[model samples]
Target: MGEAARYDVVQISDFRLPGGTTSSIAEEVRAQSEAGLSTALMHAAGSVTGYPIPWSTHIRRILDLPGVHVATPRDRLHATVLVIRHPTVIWSTPSTFDHVTADHVVIVVNHAAIDGAGTRHYDVEATDRRVRSLFGLDPIWAPIGPVVRGTVLQQTTEVPLRDEDWVNIFQMPEGAAERETFIGKKPVIGRHSRPQPGKWPDTKEDILAAYPNSPGYDVQILGGAKIARRKIGWIPDRWTVIPFGGEEPFDFLRRIDFWVYMHHPDLREAFGRAAMEALAAGCVAILPPYMKALFGDAALYAEPHEVLALVDEHWSSPEAFLAQSRRAQEFARSFSPQMHLRRLQELGVAVPETGATRQDEPAVAGTDAQAGASAGPQPTFVLNLDPQDLGLARELTRGLSATGSPVVMGLVADGAEKDPLGPDEIRLPGPPAFHLVEETGAGTWRRYITQRLRRLLADVGARRVVTVGTTIPEPVMEAFDGQAVEHHWVRPDDGSPLDVQLAVRMNAVSAIAADAAPETLAVTILKESTL
Candidate 1:
């Protein structure tokens, strides 16, 4: 907001990524705007999982809306209501919200819950504790659905979580309202999620029992079948497989008669957005037993082995299927766009009588500080993190991030002299905030310096590299040279300014391999892979 405009609602979220949380937040902003509320939005710098949150088209459109302005860090903005979409931002970068007024109603919404805490997958209990501990603010804890709410309280950890039921803000897609019952001999059943193991059943048998590979059934899968390939060792030849983003979710949901979803035991789903959307689109959802608390009467819940029985029960009677489909749609509609407005109104927030107008088009994502910065490739800086050189590494990394160049700092073990005794050791001891990546696999000293470094650099899409503190070893340089990438070194003691010195060569680089976040998700994805 140019002149420090006050907002009725301010939402802070991972608008940096495309998925359930961002999509819901975008819709939330739209709903607020439509209800005559002035809304502002901000994106968290750190995501829960250190995943790549790209600047995609969908993200751009939401930020470009008429009433939805970026809540710039520079502005001392006030809000009647302040929303933190997930615990990720507030817990990681609490200072981002410092500009907003403290008098507003603060709501922290938890979208996902991990049972065990770690660096990547955040702990639910730990986050709840941290939010209460860090800010004197006793924020209303709003979990996305019953799953999240239940998951939080079920935890043995004692955190006074003022848990409130806040189902996801969702509705049927543009043309998904008029769906008829299936009457064919062969039925099509499917599931759409980010093809991860945690999103599927624990065992192949459990998976196959629910999502049958039998000849009589036609199975359609969106969000990739890589999990299927990894779990089953081969995707069933009978199934139709499409990667995530390959097709629209509603289109895939429409093609299927049933939405069958059963995840691993450890996965506290938090909320099933895809299934909710399917229900909105009039697909009969066959969910697990626990989901009954959230979806109630809308979706049939049974163990994986019992899913087909439920599917068959309705299949035998088209009228019954149609009736259940109607119930599903009816239930999903209860969480309509207006529900968001209703929730805010309950808290005594003033909402406008007239609706805000919507315009079509998208603008780039950024705050006031990033106003002039273009969204192109990110810049890679390899700081030599040897014990003696960490001071320079920290200074160099700090400056690179200031340039808004999507910095990727490498924390390599080969260069460090301290910890090599442990065969399977991983050292990520950090200079906080800056992400220092390194090659992960264990290897010999020779292989560590050459192949490992080359692989790590390639993953980050570093075609032109700048080494700070210590120059890359000759062997590593030679390996990169063969890959058609430029590796340049600068002495750490050089008095040159970081941003100014690199600007010219950085502009001149071929830009052939533009930097993007490394999708080093194969191993993790496989680890979570269930059928």
Candidate 2:
């Protein structure tokens, strides 16, 4: 592997490695920049809070390199194994998927130069599937594992055709029922309950004080020290307090009366994995209202604070609880593992044979920004406003002009305003390179947005459509044609208010890229220079 006079090549790095694993990736990239080599690094999206969100913040920081592009390790490993046959290959990013193949190969570079770990490990099943696709397999392909396990489990059992009288509820041993047996199902709280401040009390004294026990009903506290500490003085003599160990959480769920629990306020809680297990095990569950996003109507939602109140209303009525429990069982049965596979197949992701295969040649398309003619008489951006967005709209146009970009601005109306539009209304720090026009009309809102856009694009030959916010609406995405509009999902950098600078930037570059032939960006504004 010597230097080449002309070639397009990539280098690889694993950012998730231990400090000493592959530290060289960064230095290798810096060296390549010095040597005039094209390079990119691979990083996974950060994992979710409880789930270990893939492509974590760490990966994001690493890939924010000035000139480097980002790729996924899952894709890279596949390319290395199938196409390069080497220990490493520059993992291809989503943007680069169609460009590379097994036949046309290049030299592999490691992140060791930058002290990068070789390749980070992930779940074998997930990695294998990603690798298969990188090797030119159809994206719809998958490996057999839990997906299959779920199917096998579903096949061996039979849920009662109709709702059963007894419903069991299972969940994390964190919180217990505010009011058990609100409906027909008895409350079978988790066995591994942990005591957390505010949510759980050190003793059930508060709960008992809140509600004196009636007949046929008892409260049990589950989990380890967390549960024991919380239920210290709370548990009644009749109810059994069990310490859950190993993966027998579900086994305990099987012995439960009903599932009752609440979720965190973030609304990111899992939809009762234990509840699902209980439903399979023939238990009814009473869910918190927030769970509708995941469980739908399968579980009943009691207000988080109204547990005892719920027991008084729903639990006290055994007939009502039984009916609700039946619904839960029916709903759980609908999500059998075969149903998952069937759904995937329906989505065109599981076709046994797809016509998608790797091409011998690279893609040639309009994907990159064309080294264009010099910036024209600064861009004159026209901020077209509807009646609702006139004020902020004006501010946006003014902001752009203030940034030294030429901008013309206006409002859309059903009819033209008789009063002449003034420059004070249109001009900000910078002047419009051309005349700013405001027009109003009916039955032409789409035409108005488009015409204003085209006018601005043409006047100064603008290269981008930068909007002040996402509230610009769905119609805009459709009007620009789905192929061209790109949303800039901007998250705040300084921990500003969640709503603070949410804007959209329609990248003419990406529009051109999508429209490009094969992999080559076919159309770009050719920047011509003055003599």
Q: Which regions of candidate 2 are displaced past 4 Å?
A: 1-216, 225-239, 244-247, 263-267, 312-316, 346-531
Candidate 1 ranges with C-alpha deviation above 4 Å: 1-4, 56-58, 94-96, 112-136, 155-164, 355-531
Poorest stretch of ten by lDDT in candidate 1: 359-368
Encode model 1's per-residue lDDT on 1-531: one tens digit a residue.
212335677777665555777777777877765665667665666545466635333555554344455444434556667777777666676354444553444545555554423123446666666655543455677777766766555553455544467777785678866566583567888888986777777778887888788998888888887876777778888888898989988877878898888777666666778778889889889987877888889988989899889888888888899999999998877888877787788766776666443311111122221222224544443435454554454454455455444445554332223322121111222222123233311122233344445654544455545454333344444455556554444444444334433334333231111122122111221223231
- TM-scores for all candidates: the values are 0.63, 0.31
Q: Could you tell me the C-alpha RMSD of candidate 1 in Å?
A: 15.7
lDDT (tens digit, per residue) of candidate 2 on 1-531: 111111122333334332211322343333333333333344322221123222222233333232334332322211211112112222332333432333223222111111112222223234234445544543221211222222222333221111111011222223222223342245444323323332343345534432234445555544433443455544455555555333355566656555555432322222234456555544455555645655666666665455556555655666776666566666666543333223323333222232332111111122111111135344433334344434444555555545544444433322212211334222111112111232322123333333334432343344344333324443344444443322222111233443323232433322111122211211111121111
RMSD of each: 15.7, 23.9
TM-score of 1: 0.63
Which lDDT value does model 2 have at 92?
30
